[model samples]
Structures are given as structure tokens and as C-alpha cells.
Target chain A: MTPSTDAPHSCTRSEDELWASLGSPPDAHELQCLTCQEQRRRLAPLAQAAQEWKTGTDPEESLLEGILGRVMHGIRTEIRRGTLFTLTVTPLGPLRISSYLLLEAIRDAVDSIEHVELRTHKIIPHADDAGPISLAVSLAMQAGQDGTEVAEETRRTIAARFAERIGMPIGTINVTVEDVFQ
Target chain B: MSGPEKPDQQQLGNLVARAQSGDPRAFEKILTYHQRGLLRFCTSMLVVPGDAEDVLQEVYLTAWRQLSTLHAPEALGTWLYRIARHRCIDHLRKRTPQPRDLQGPESLAGDIAASDDRSGENPESNAETNAAMTDLRRFVHELPANQRECWVLKEIHDLSYADISAIVSEPIATVRGRISRARTTLAERMRPWK
Candidate 1:
């Protein structure tokens, strides 16, 4: 007979030999030592019982959902606490814009990113002084009824534009996709 | 599973970036991705469903609040597990009705924590196994407290002996001994299923 898929935690051997030892094998000095045989004999039922206990308990669906909800809600609550925005000035800066306009655009862009809980994470410059700064953007997206990829692209696009309009050239535009999600 | 695996690194990385910068949605995605393993570890270690859930929430909240502290993005699984283990231990300590000790010395009292001495055998004696399971659960609970805990952490949870030793602040030998005896006594008590 083919061996059963499940194994006793103790046996650590083949079934054929396990019972074979029951008939003929080594003695206390040879193998299958008397105590080992007796121990195996004793442990047979408990191992079976453990397998049942392991399979018996099913994870709670509602409990898992509730835990996930609490975690996600906690993150959202942290996001809403305050707005932390990053500003990137490119080599191709318009150079003559009022500082007020620049700040306003950035603030507005920050709002746009956070509106959907996505935002400008890092500003990666291509060179020591690359023109149109390369923006390394991170978007924390919440997948809505809208498809996940669609939401991600939308967030990425919004972040890219915001980086461009912040009165600076954004080069090497790259999105460090963190989560595709939901 | 808490959330489906993203399967692609680019997507997960993007979400992580957004999360670090205050994008609540991105952080939430990460949370959903990792909740189950954390919960499972907690449930197994705590040995109580309710306490496990409570620790799960606390662990996640702490994970969020301290998210920025984690340096390795890919090591999130291991990091979260470590935190879960710590939190469960704390929760268990609070709920366990006993004095504080790292690992109580091994004694025969530890041997018979549950009872039974090798009568398990034959299909007809299966009832012995059933009773042992119930007894084993409580027996471990009645262990010298520390040895009981060390046994659970090392044997049942499949955590490393060293890890169990560190968690209980006991010597590795102590950890191994307790585990060996815990299994020994339990095995002798319920030997038919072997």
C-alpha cells in the first residue's frame, strides 16, 4: 500500500519499516530499540488527534475583516492628520515666477494627491544638476469601484502633472509603484 | 489571506511610497496585504482567539504609527511577525494568572502537568487520545508557567529554540529540555496516535 500523505511528527521513518519492525528488526542494541517501539506504539493515537485539532479550527471571516478594517482605518486616520508635501525646483525653472504662486501650486498639488490619499514622496534628480528634475513619486492608492490599475494610473498622472506645474522641469519621470492593491 | 498578493513589485512599491508620504490609501493596502500571517501567528502563540484578535489590532496600529521606522521594505513580513510575537507575549503575560519567572526549573511536576503515562495503544483505546488533547491543552497551561510557555513557543508554534529562549529570557538548554519533556510527557500520555 502507498504510504499515507500525513505523517506522525515522531516517526521520522517509512511506514513499511515501522510496522516491519513490529515483526523483525534490531534489538535494544541493534535498532528499533525496545523503548523506541513502545514509544511509537504509545504515540500513535495522539498524533492522529493533533491532526484533527489542526484541521478542526477554521479562521473567523468576520474577525479577519474587522481587523483589516481597523488597520486600514488607522492608516487613513494618520493620513488625515496633517499634510506633508515636498517641493522640487528643476534646472529649467521658469525662474521669474512669484514665490507665492509656486507655493500655491505646490499646496494645491499636495491637496490633489492627498484628496485620494496619494502624494509626492521623493524628488529624484537625474544628475548632479539635471534639468527638469526627475520626480520619484509614491502614490498611496485606495482601490475604489474604479479598477485598481485605473486608480493607480490616475494617481500617478495627477502626481506627475503636479510635479511639472510646480514651476519646474521634471525629468526621468518615474513612479515607484508600492502597491497595486485591494 | 488578508488581501490578494499584488504579484508585481512595482505596484507594491508605489503603494508603499504613497503611504510613507501620508497617502492613507497606500498604507491601507499594505495593511490588508499582511494581516493574516500576523493574525495566525498571534492566535497560535496566544492560544486564545479573543486575545489573539486584540493583539492583532494593537500590532497593526503600532505598525502604522511606526511605519516610517522600518528601513527594509521587503523585510516587512519578518518585521511584522517579530512585532506580533512581542505583542502576544505581552498580552499573555497580562492575562496569565501567575507570578513572573523566565523559565521554571524542570521537575516531574512538569512531567505530569497533564497526566497519563503510556497507556495509549490500539484502535479501541482511541478515547485516550481525545482526553489527552484536552488535558494537554490545560497541562501546558498549568506548566511551571515559564516552562509551559517555552514549550508552547518552541514546540507547538514551531518557533526556533533560540527564539523561544530569547522570548522567555531562558537558556537554550532550558528551552530544549522543556520542549523535549513537554512532548515526552504529552506523548506518553497520548501514545496511541503515533
Candidate 2:
């Protein structure tokens, strides 16, 4: 018997429908139709190959280590060129710090708190030289922990750390519990 | 080869949020989790291992730089795949169009065979497996780029039609049509294997 082409021949169901039927159990019409059954049998190998390809382990898994190294190196270099923010005005020049540094400090402060994990934090510095900075932090609290208490504690910790690091008052610290983790 | 176990949705969300906040470790974690799948996708799209690696690197770097732009944390996997697809297209466009260079059936087949760990299997069985895989890859490579993209996204990557539509920036109907067309082509071409 000749192999079926992609076009529908005399059968009412198109070849595409036959191919799709291979994915599921045959319906009543499909069970009764010789054309559909033959087409499906021919299409079975391709379907099986696709399934194997999806579930099989990647051949290039070994290259991931090298790729990761290269990618992380690129990211770190970019991180080093961090955005510079003016911390305060000095006698001769403005005291500036990299946003990377500020973020790291905030991360450390958040990490020091128990039962609370920092998801994201944004520091909005005031436009003027010596105005209060606004801090927004999203956190994930440990399951069964008090979210309100954790948020309050996280806010106080970040506030104290920010005051010590920059000697500036914090304006409205927003601490939102974005997730709960075990 | 078996892929790594993916993190749960909540864990993935947490990682994305942390990465957005300039956490290098979190970003690296996210990248590592997705590396194998993305690399396979790039390899299929580019057909050149070196070029695939370059595009994969660009995908990660772009994702990291634009991490803030990704508002939906749960969509990171699809988002990364989209970046990869774009990068692969750009890379292919920049190449000096050589039809011969586009075909790399042996490359993927060799990689799979080399990495095959069925040590206890008989040599004849292994060879048959390799031959079948080579044929499969060749038939897939013979597909038109658009059909190949849709087919690979649907079959190999196991993406839904909607997700494939989002990645390819086409309508769901279009994506479905392309995949169906691809299936028909492959079904006809791979009849001997059946």
C-alpha cells in the first residue's frame, strides 16, 4: 500500500486530523475508518520520536558548566559597572556609592532577620542632598509565622541599618509580604 | 538525557523577585535551572553548537538586564525562551546565508549518541537507536524554519499552543496550523520508521 500524503484523499477527515488522533484514543468514526487507522499507524513513529525527544536527557548537558561560567562572568562585569548614586554632599565633592553596594547592604540587613526572606527591595533616594530616602521591600515569611510581626521587624532592621550606613532618616518604609515559604 | 527537576512555582517566583532586586546568586540559580532546555532550543534553531552557545549567553544576559521589565514572575520560563527565539532569529539573519551551513543533523545526533549512557545495551541496539535518532533529526531539519520552530516548540519543548503562540508572537490559530503542517510533513517523511 502507498503511504498517505499530507492532503486528504477520498476520506472526509483530513490527514491532519488523522495525525492528531494519534495523540488520543480513536473516536467512533476513527475506529471504523480504515483510512484514518492506516494514516495514524504511519504517523505513530513521528509522535513517538517527539515524545522521546521531549523526555530524553539533553545531549549537550555537559556544556552547561562552561556556558554558566561565561554568562556569570558577563553579568558580574556588568554588575561592577553599577549605577552610581549620590549619597550625600561633601565639602569638595558629592559622596557617591554604587547602587550595587547599597543593594548588597540592604540584602545583608534583610538576610540577618530570622523567619523572613527578602524577595525584592527598591531604594528611592530623595532628590535633595539631605532628604529622607524611601525603601520598599517585598518579603516571604516562613510558613506559620506572623506576617505583620515579621514585616515590622524587617522594617525596623532595614531602617536601623540604613541610618547607620548613610546617616539619613528613612521616609515611609513599605514592607509587603509577597509570599510565604516553609 | 534527563533534565533537572524544575523548582515549584512559588520557588521560581521567589527566585525571579530576588534576581530582579540585583541578587546575582538568585539570577544564577534561575539561569542554571533553565540552561539545558534553552541550550537545546538554541541548538535546534541555530543548528551550530558554537552559535547556539553564543545566542544562549546573549539570552541570559538580556534576561538579566531586562529582569525588571518582566512583571509576571511565573512567566520567566516562557520569557527566557522568547528571548532565545529572538536571539536565534537575529543570529540567523546576520549570517551570510549558506544553505549547507544550516544543516547539522550529524551534530545533534552525535551529541545524543555520545551522551547516551545505555552501557548495558547491545552494540547493535545502540547503533539502531542512533540511526533512528539521526533520521529523526534530519527529517526535522529538513522542515521549513517556521514549521520547524513551531514543531520543536510544541513537541520537544512541550509547550502549549498558547505558549508557543506567545513565544513566536503569532496567533494561536497560526501556531496550531504551523504545527499541524509540520506534523503532516514529518508523518509523511518518517513513514519508513513506523
Candidate 3:
């Protein structure tokens, strides 16, 4: 009897393998098999639809602009609320004052001093209740202005403003005369 | 599947770094880069465009707050998709239970028509194609969430199986299975058109 010469009638690969192969061309077996070819044909529209869905449509410009507005508003709100450490008052409830506002107040006070320019202000929160809040303020004094006098006057003005406006007492104000500009 | 290509890795990394360090402009860049894809992802999962936009709003807000928790800057796309998916699912869960048809094709078609009109597209010219798309949209919306998401991330977005797996929090094998099943169901439904 002649040896059996016919190839196997069915694809050896599982359905999962066939589906995974969808990204690439079908192999020889799949090309020859009517069943796999039919399946591939059915899957073609889906791939085409996917391509069409992506290329044919775009997000509404209004939607994009709206999202940008919302995100920016959110970030601003976050910054306004995020930089402060709440100070708990004994009799009153919690008082929330942002470090940014505090810096602005300090700048206003320093700017009022004659021939003194406010460079920057930083709040150094006390590690413990043993010390009150401290501020480091940098000022550029005019060439003829007395450095010591301007520093002292700016320090007192900021402290008084913090007490008057912020209802918070300051332990110390460190004035750094950064430069003497003409 | 080849979905939308991500922004270049190093560029995205720099954006993420700047955003993490409290640069709002950098963060806005990130949001703008991902917004459209995330919006489409949300719309595919939710019925209302407004609701989808709402979810995206929340997603970006939460991302801003929790950006520091993110370990990988390059993975922002997947992270954003995951957030959008969770928010969309939550939005769905909170809606009062109603018959699915209450939010069906008629409304979606109306949305399509209105959107087309606004965009100056001649819906009359593409009536047949629009009708077919409406039917396909309805069929897709009817699918279970897992299958629908799998299909969206896979075919529609052209994301790889591994990327879909990460976004959906499923094994690669599971992702492939969901996509295959979804394709089969959609193919069966689309046969009439064919």
C-alpha cells in the first residue's frame, strides 16, 4: 500500500492564536482554510470601523477649551488653599491664612519705607509652639539710606501690620539688607 | 492594535517632572495632550457627553492633587485612562437604575445630528453612513462594560493588549478574551449590514 500522502485537514493553531495573529497576515494554513478566511473577512469591517472612528472624528473644540479652563481654575484654587498651615487659636476656631497672603502683606509694609525696596519675604513656621512665627525679609536700601535704620524700621512696620491685619503676633523679624542700590 | 501614538517619552517625562514639581503650565500641557483621547474614552463608556466631560474634569482635578503619588511619568497615558475608566464606572453606578433604552439610540442619534449641525457637517449628505454609525454605536453601547472597554481600548484606541491590560487592570490573556468576545458580538450584529 502507498504511504498516506495527504496533509492534516485542520489548522493546528487554536482560536486564540488565530485571533492574536490578526495584527499580521494569516499564515499558509489560514490562507488555504476556508473557515479562517471567512473569519478574517468578518473581522475586517471591525478593523476598518476602528480606523474610521479614530480618523473621522475629533473632539469638539468647545470641549477642549472648557477642559483647559476647568483645569486651570482647579489649579488656582489648589494653590490658594494648599500653601498654608492652619493656626489653631485657643478660644477661636481655626484661622486659615495663606503664606502667599502673608508675604504680600510683608511686601506692602516694606515697600512703604522710604528709599527701601522689598526684594522677597519668606515665612519660617515655628517647629514648636515655644516660638512664634518668624519672617526673613530681604530689602534693597538706597545708597544714601542708613542700612541699620532702614532694616529696623522695615522690621517694626511689618510686625505691626501682621498684628493689626493678620491678628497674629510675630516673635522675630530678620531683615537682610541684600543690596544698597543707587 | 495601533491606536493613537503617545507623545514622545522624553518630552512626556519632562512635562510630568515639571508638573510634579508644581508647575501649572506644564500640568496644563499634559492635560491638553491627553484630553481628546481621554474624552473619547469617556464618551465611549458613558451615554452623555456632558457626563463624560464631567468625569474628565474630575479626572484632571484628581490627577493634579495626586500627581505626586505617580511613580512613572512615562505611564501617564495609562494612568489617565485608568482614572477615566474608574470615574466613568462610578458615574454609571450612581445613576438611578433605569431601563437601558431610556438612554438609547434615539438620543444618541439626536446628539450626533446636533453635533453635526454645529460642526457644519452636511448630515444629509452622509445620512446613510450616519444611520449605520448610529446602529453600530447602539450595538457597542449595549455591550457589557468589560467587553466594551476592551473593544474601545483595543480596536478603537489601537492600544496594544498589554496597554489595555494595564489600563483595565486585567491580565493580557483576559484582555484578549474580552476583546475577542466583543468583536464576535459586534461582528454578529453587523452581519445584517454586511
TM, every model: 0.53, 0.81, 0.64
Best by lDDT: 2
Q: Write the per-residue lDDT of candidate 2 for residues A58-154, one digit (tens) a residue.
A: 6676788998898898887788688766777789987776777677777988999988878988878777736666778999889999888998898
CA-RMSD of model 2: 5.5
For residues B15-133, write the lDDT of model 1, one tens digit per residue: 55555655555666786776755565565566554777889889978877777876656656556766776787788778854432222454445545424344343434547555555
Q: Indicate the TM-score of model 3.
A: 0.64
Rank order (by lDDT, best first):
2, 3, 1
Q: How well does candidate 3 score on lDDT at residue B101?
A: 41
Error at A76, model 2, angstroms: 2.3
True contacts kept of 3: 0.26
User: What is the C-alpha local distance difference test score of each model?
Assistant: 0.54, 0.78, 0.71
Docking class of 2: medium
lDDT of 1: 0.54
Number of the top-ranking candidate, with DockQ as the measure: 2
Tens digit per residue, CA lDDT, model 1, A34-113: 54555446545545554444434335435887877876766555544443322444477524333233323433454465
Ranking by TM-score: 2, 3, 1
In model 2, state the lDDT of residue B92: 86
